[model samples]
Target: MTSPTSRRTVLTAALAAAAGAGTVASAASASAAPTSPAGSSAAPGALVDNRFWHTYTDWRCGTGDGTRVLPGPRPGVVIAVPAGRTDYTDPHTGRTAAWDYATWTSSVHRSAVPATEVIASWNARTPTGTWIQVELSGVYGDGTATPWFVMGRWAAGDGDIRRTSVDGQGDPHSSVWTDTFSVDDPASGVRLVSYRLRLTLYRTPGSRLTPTVWRVGAMASDVPDRFTVPASTPAPARELPVPRYSQNVHIGQYPEYDNGGEAWCSPTSSQMIIEHWGRRPTAEDLAWVKPGLPDPQVCHAARQTYDYQYEGCGNWPFNAAYAATYRDLNAVVTRLGSLTDVERLIRAGIPVITSQSFLKEELTGAGYGTAGHLMTVIGFTPDGDVVANDPASPDNDAVRRFYRRREFENIWLRTKRYDAAGKVRSGTGGVCYVYWPTRTTPGQQRVLRSLGLL
Candidate 1:
């Protein structure tokens, strides 16, 4: 049913809106330089830039049409008035209807590290019959502009519209592959120098319902192409008490969501961390799952994060958005510089979900190879090896694994690697999902701040 090498894997692989395409709105706000994901370091090796607009001022600076900035412990933007109405056809369901909509566009942001790839993420509360669309447009180093690419169409639940991502979007400079905005060829030296995000919220007509967006941002990077990455000695060895769920156990249970369980590494890992923070779907929420199934919440996660367009549950930002839907939890899609960064979070009692691709022999003890996969980094061994909850295992009992430090780091941090056939392919270059609670312990805050995650 799915292509073997389609951008969805060797085992696997990796939206939107508005009937009125003629509507346009823009505003003027101050611009700022992007900050490195690891910190303010200007090191040449600091190739990742993370810029998010979340504070009250961040919302105030946006050019908004019928949008209001909510200020408090957590500030966000909601539709105060409908800017206009447009009919959107749910591509998955083939249902077309009209809805009132408003938009908030961020001011232009210049990347501190000019990027060859970019991925956008957001945290929002979309009530029933409501949803939000996020888009990114940017300028190249040559000052040439790129078309606005839809990053995601999201909602907290599936009662209204099927959450999805857009495809076939690109310009001469770049193209959007699944959820990532990538330069057609990074070897040409052309890169996205800066960008802006646009959030369009929609709800049923004449209803006061609005989607409150708490955070919206993107991670832009220009990681060097290499078969390996620089190694680092581990720090403060500590293993987190993270739960594990094997994707293989449910292989044929819900084939409708990304060909069933075999391709659910992203959502599976997400559910593990979400519960690590003590949140889960209610019985009513799990009512849809048939009885006798172990960890139905994993099924719930698969459905909640399923992307109709991509036809897979591996969308990076969609997984992060799913985690944020829980109370008091905040999640972002970012790139870390090294395993030391992951070690810092582990010491703070936080486990991280990381994206990478590797051959079976490349990572000793991994029974299979994948073009794209996600694993939870729970802790480290005394020998500095990686302790992971690998969802690809045959059962929950087989989920915990200790991968050799040198071997795991190269597979997880490298931007390029050779497949089983020895053909070169792109790596995630340290892309990960970092989730934490709104109320964090002092130790958590201190470690998060040290890594620039706060």
Candidate 2:
């Protein structure tokens, strides 16, 4: 095993070289395993059906719902890409297990530690061979963040895809070594998925480090065939100022209200995007919209005309909630349902505004506003600020504000239905809604700049 001190030395040297460059060296290759499909190294136990595919989180256990353990690898992990692949499967019922994407969360688990973090994944192609890809997105630690540090490794059968990978005999069942160290050796899907992932956060012997485990899968399989590789037509980049609009607004169960009785939660929010930001719908924007969602079975003619694309709480398609069970938040729920619809939107480079309605009514009553509503967050900010596109006032336009990070995340948690109660103890249903611009793509940025969203 490489000593902790040695690991820190390696990371520091790499980071020092990366300073000011805005880029980190990624693993040699990001290709999938290349074994001929299905020769069967060892079959995974059983693919169980799970419903959390819409949210994101760590430590997915393949039970009857979202995941199942295969026979060969006990407690192995699978990362699916190109968005619709199932990471785990049950041979019995053909049921696949998954986690919700919206709820997915990650942490190093070590307290006060700074070191390189590598996310490894194991994947298999049905029948014959399995392909696995691993990469390092960035180095995140106290007061430090970088989203561009990327590296990847891929091995196909006995032939290594990347020049940096170590050669394996049959299928990665141990006995592999790379240039870095013996531990960083590449292996096959059969062996990689067999063991629980270890949270390896490099730190000094006595530094306070928090341990973190990243959740990999989405509510559903929504990853693309290739990440790390730039899109063929890079979507234009436009930054919008998110708002804390309606943070004090209340919610009710009245039919008049849009988001679980909070009328302004979505429509009004959408209005802000158009009226203030000058974002209108384009042909592509209209392509993914879905109406009458976040409360399934309750369809409205108005929303269904456009594809709302977002499948998080109170979004569309999966928008069904009964007094009896959890809410459905998707227009199309093909597999494990936890991957949040917002994730898909962001990946597609669509700028969005999501709202969290407050439950103010009595628990026994049908409608009420418990907390604030109508806040917005854009793409993740390196500064940890809650990004927003507020239209309330010109001063607050398309700005990044450092709202109490913890508080802001907590509020979003409540809105996403991840929070059981308003204050964690006052348990009530929580839901979030997305407000997209009429236009899709950075072309919206062109329109916004012409209209001064700049």
Candidate 3:
């Protein structure tokens, strides 16, 4: 549980007032600045900052049976709830609501970065049988709007679609969900001139469960030079001594969490970091997991971070938020500038979970092509090569692998690709998950200060 900070207090008060009046509160509107060409080739810059636009002041809301906007988990956050029952004909079971939905739509705005991709994210608190689906549409240079694309539908717990909890009871739990969609393909002449988002909330009838939403926002990015200049001498091959954990070892262990280990990369990497910090889950916490698992804690993480709507556990922000749920720990998902930036975190004894995609021949040692995969960047060799606990390895003994610094950097930074038909496809670029304890150690503080992130 998180301690009450000033932001949390303000958000709680705002939500309570809104809930009492059964009305939505307005928030200030935000807009992106005009786009400017990035600087010299040697010094690329961020196209979009990692801040969220939470003030729904200008957003429009709609509901089939009335709706209420409540407060979210933190300040600048709000929840959209559907009100009244949709099943008015069934007098005997009038409480059984019909198919009701509450929606919020954002005003369209042009990007200042000539964005090729847009990432939508949200934090949701949902009861059993409740879920949310998000869609995005982009306005092209021709002033034509792209068709609504389903980013993802999200709910807590496992399973391919939205359903009640495993035990047939409503479990009030929350998790963060994010999806990155392609908007502008350099090959295509259509540049995204403006974009808008729509969020729909759904719940089952006879269930009073209401879904809550927070931090709904989007980030845009333009392609950067994949091969930026490396350090003059490769920062003295420094690698933090961390434990190696493998996801392959747990394959077929839990069917509910994507048939076990094959898709457990994100949670597995997160579990490794949590254990490295000496904050393993207690027996009581893992009590819900089935028995006979070698590491119940890992299974617990897999279950907690699993995304029902996405049918995968690799949601970027969800894994980071899962780490934050632990006492004295905090985490965030963001994009890093370069390998040198990653080194700063390693030097501070922090392990970073990074997303990457590669064909079998593209990356040495790893004989596979994954549209997306997560691994822990633990350290660097004396020659500046990367040393990572790659969970995609075939077995536990092969989990730790080394790669050429340039090769690893290329795969990590540049994830966009094209098909034979000349269509664009990609994952989130230069994305990473950073987890740190709330009470920072001296080493952690030094690294944070040097990076100007503290």
- Which one wins on lDDT? 1
The number of the candidate with the highest TM-score is: 1
When summed lDDT is taken over every stretch of 10 residues in candidate 1, the lowest stretch is 11-20
Candidate 1 residue pairs that clash:
8-13, 8-14, 9-12, 9-13, 15-165, 15-166
The C-alpha local distance difference test score for the whole of candidate 1 amounts to 0.82
**Which candidate, 1 or 3, has the higher TM-score?**
1
- Model 1: per-residue Cα lDDT over 106-209, one tens digit each: 87877778999999999999999799989887888887776667788888887788888776667776777778888878989999887888899999999999
The TM-score, computed over Cα atoms with residue i paired to residue i, of candidate 3 is 0.64
* Worst-scoring 10-residue span by lDDT in model 3: 1-10
The RMSD (Cα, Å) of candidate 2 is: 22.0
Worst lDDT run of 10 residues, candidate 2, spans 320-329
Judge candidate 3 against the unseen true structure and give its global Cα lDDT, from 0 to 1. Answer: 0.57
Clashes by residue pair, model 3: 15-71, 27-57, 239-379, 251-261
Residue 220, candidate 2: C-alpha displacement in angstroms = 7.4
Candidate 2 structure quality by residue, lDDT tens digits, 209-289: 211211221111111111112112223333444333331122332222223323223333433333334333344434433
Please state the error at residue 413 of candidate 2 in Å.
2.9
TM-score of each: 0.92, 0.25, 0.64
